[model samples]
Target: MLRFAPSPTGDMHIGNLRVAIFNYIVAKQKNERFLLRIEDTDIERNIEGKDKEIMEILKKFNIKWDELLYQSQNINFHQNFAYKLLQEKKAFACFCTPQELEIEREKAKKEKRAYRYSGKCEEITIEEASKRAEPFVIRIKKPKSSIKFEDILKGKMSFDPNEVDSFVILRADGRPTYNFACAIDDMLHDITYVIRGEDHLSNTPKQIHIRKALGYTKDIIYCHLPIILNIHGKKMSKREKASSVKWLLEEGFLPEAIANYLILLGNKTPKEIFTLNEAIEWFDLKNLSNSSPKFDIDKLRYINREHLKLLQEEKLAKLLGYEDSQIGELAKIYLEEASTLNELKNKIDKIFNEKRDYKDFEKEANILKENILEVIKNSENFDEFKKELMKKSSLKGKQFFKPLRIMLTNQEHGPELSKIFPILKNKIEEVAKWW
Candidate 1:
């Protein structure tokens, strides 16, 4: 099974969604279960409605999960396991004050040595430790040997035992630390694959130690995706507004477009665009780029436009919140002329602009107006008028409709002449009087 565990600290950002999408694809490709786990261990930073909003967005993008787990609800389970490790002599408690640890760290740095816990309280008997403990954080005792693991993507990664930090498994307040909680949760949930961002790669060695101590030797596959960076080549963050998914949503990006663009970040692809299913078929961890991918708004917009163009009129209308009846007409106009939604909106603005007058017509209108007016004035019927107009003007359909479009709708370009004419047929006489 695959799982996407996101902390509900803030809105779901684009970088986070990239990881979710990658995990979702892997699950679908392998016909395995995809689960959603809420890593809300950090209660202070939790945002209300964030989990619901994340679920809603994932649903909108068609990403599904088999189970929903909350770390906060399993506090007892984690505590029990932490205590078990302590009993087995694989973990220990330290009552070191913040100042003392900082001083030790600084001394090590000054001496160009790795800063680590000096085992200050490692030898203290349980009774003596109980007496001295004002408030203590539990730390895992690192084994004095090298640890090795095979990363699914990076491969054969190893870390020396001494280099690994003696991390806190339980806080002074009794809450489980992130590393401890993640290891316990992964084991409890039977997660076979650990797919997450590369930022968590450093924490892997520590988790491996915990897994070993707990006797979980069935090596889990770990695939760390590359980080997403801003266009300036810096790691993306909320401070960099450009990286936020909420910002893109606010700027009118369709969910499909965002999902498609995100898949391009690290995955190898020769094609410029792909549908959700196509992306799943093409997704492979081996093809992921090692370097951080830059988020480009322009490229995202281009990809969105292509997807928008391919959408069925009804779906497009539903996504854009236009009425069903308005869909066909609007889509026809959009497909025929506009390269983008903005362009279509601009044309709509021209249609509704009350200030536009006959004098605002293009120069070509002034050149052809006299002949057009004379032909209209002399014609005996609508059919005769059409025939005469077609004969006098060498313009084909587009040129023929150009003047009529400006006359009836006061717009330079829009829906096809046939479609636009039928919709504006009643206004033809009123516009003919202009010439």
Candidate 2:
């Protein structure tokens, strides 16, 4: 089993989406069950409706999961596990106050040493703690030896016992901490594989410790993908506009194009461009690079443009609010200047919605504009049409071509009229009468 566990805290980050894509693709490649686990246990930080927003985004990306679960719903199981650890003396309750812990932390800072938990409550007996009125938190007993595991991507990893102090399993308010709940849920779901961001690397050992303490012997395959950096070479942050998947979609990026770009990042692919379905055939976690990959908007735009070209002409026309397949072909002419669906649509919209006043060459331009339909109908091609239109207006050189150009395309400069007039011939009446 594989899972993409996201916290319901904010907008879905692009990095997280990439992780989801990797997990989903790997699950398909392995023929394993995939699941989405919303770690909504941090009720204080979770935003309302964010979980639904996450589901909507997943749907947009076509990432179907076999199971959907919220971490909060397993509160009973988490509590039960915590009690089990306490009963076995593997964990104990601590009555330390926040202020008291801070003072010890400050003393450690002054002494230039790491602040390890003092384990002051390790001697507190269960019956003695049950009789006490003070609020306390359950903390797992610190491991005596190093915690080690082999990450599928990062490879052999180890953390010393001193690095992992006795950490809280259940908070004073009875809510499970992130690592505790994550470990328990993975064990409960029998998750055999975990593909996630490199930010979770440090938390892996802690989760492993939790599982070991619970006597859960099964091991989960871990692949920690490299961090995605911005163009400035800094870690991508949610504060950046391009970091949000919703922002990218609103900006007119095709979902498939985004998936293609992400899969190509930090990994070797069979080809430069491919669909999500194509990726599943060859994607392997072992092939991924450990080096961080930079998020390039220009690269994404290039990929989106290619994906656009791969669309059916009729479907491309529909995206631009047209039914004619020729209109779709006409839209492709502007691909040199437009990279996104919105930009392409704007280019097509200008053809049918622009108002041409013919102010500079009012008489000459108007004469050609008025006779455009008749001249175009009579002539089979642009050269023939231009020749006949000039003859009708008795105009030549700049006077002849400038007004004709404005009258036809409503712009003084653009793609040569020769290339445009052919595809646009059938739509001439609409273009001329648009004003």
Candidate 3:
């Protein structure tokens, strides 16, 4: 089984969604069960409805999971496992006070050394600790040897025994820490694969230690995807509005387009554009780039336009709040200048709704409007229509075309009239009436 575990802290970033896409697609390709685990154990930081919102976003992207779970549901199990480790002598109670630990940390800083637990509390017998009134935390024993594992994308990796101290499993507040809960849940849920961001690479050995301490000898495959950089050549930050998936969706980006762009990043694909289903046929983990990939908004906009073009003319028009296929075809002409559905809709709306100001050319605009209304009915095309109207007005150059362009498109400049005129030939009367 595979899992896409997200914390309910705030709006999910595109980085989070990209990780989910990788896990979901790989699970389907392997014919394995997929799970959505909402890691909401950090109650202090979790937003109340964000988990439901996350599921909704996943559904919008067509990600289906075989099972769903919240990490808090197994709090009892996580607590019990900590006690189990203590009983097996795989862990010990930590009696260090906050001030004492801080002093040790300062000492390490002064000595220019890494701050690890002094393990002073290990000398206290468990029986002796059972009778103490002071509150204490549970900590797993440090490994005596290196913890090593192979990552599908990163290849062989190793962590020294000293790198992982006797980290706390259960806090003084009777709550399990992140690594303890994550390790316990993965073991209990039978998660065979872990595909996540490289930010969690340091936590892997700690989790592996917890599993090994519990006698879970089965190997869990791992793929730590490289970090994504913004266009400015820095790591993507979730706090930024542009990094958010919610903001991207609200800006009228297609879900398919977003997924296509994400999958195309840092990986080799059969083609530049494809649907989610098409990607499932060819996605392989081995093709992922080890180097970080930059998030190019321009490229995503280009991909969004391609996906918009793939939509049927009638359907595309419906998304733009119109029913006529002609309107849909008309919208396509604006696609040359518009990158998003909202931009396309605004461009189309300009034709029939936006009030154009003629400024210095008001007189010429009115004359052109009257002439076009009179001769447009008989003209078969824009060139034919222009020939008849220009003859009647006896106007030429900027004096003729400028006002005519504003009368037809409600804009001083836009797509060539030759391309827009064909789709909007029937709507010319309505367009002229509004202007």
Best by TM-score: 3
lDDT of 2 by residue, 1-435 (tens): 899999999999999999999889989988999999999999889999999999999998999999999999999999999989999999999999999999999999999999999999999989989999989999998898999999998889999987878999999899999989999999999999888898998888989999999889998888888999999889999999999999999888999999999999988888998999999988888888999999999999999999988888898999888999887887777777778989888778777888876667887876666677788888888889988887887889988888777766666766788888987788877886764
Comparing 1 and 2 on lDDT, the stronger one: 2
- Give lDDT tens digits, candidate 3, residues 113-195: 99999999876768988999999999999998999999999899999988988999999988899999999999999999999
Order of the predicted models by TM-score, top scorer first = 3, 2, 1
TM-score of each: 0.81, 0.95, 0.96
Q: How close to the true structure is residue 298 of candidate 2, measured as C-alpha lDDT? A: 98
Model 2: per-residue Cα lDDT at residue 47: 98
**Candidate 3: Cα lDDT at 268:** 99
lDDT of 1 by residue, 1-435 (tens): 889999988878787888888889988998989889999999899999888888887897889899998889889988988878777767787889999999999999999998889988676555665687388878888867877888777888888888676778989888999999998888888888888888998788888889889998877889887788888888887877667777676666777888989988766786768877888877788888877888888788788777777777777656554545354355446555554455555554455434345444365466456566676567656567667777776555655656656765566655555555443343335455544
The residue pairs in collision within model 2 are: none
Candidate 3 wrongly placed segments (more than 4 Å): none
Instruction: Give each model's clash number.
Output: 0, 0, 0
Q: Candidate 3 has which clashing residue pairs, if any? A: none
Which wins on lDDT, candidate 1 or candidate 3?
Answer: 3
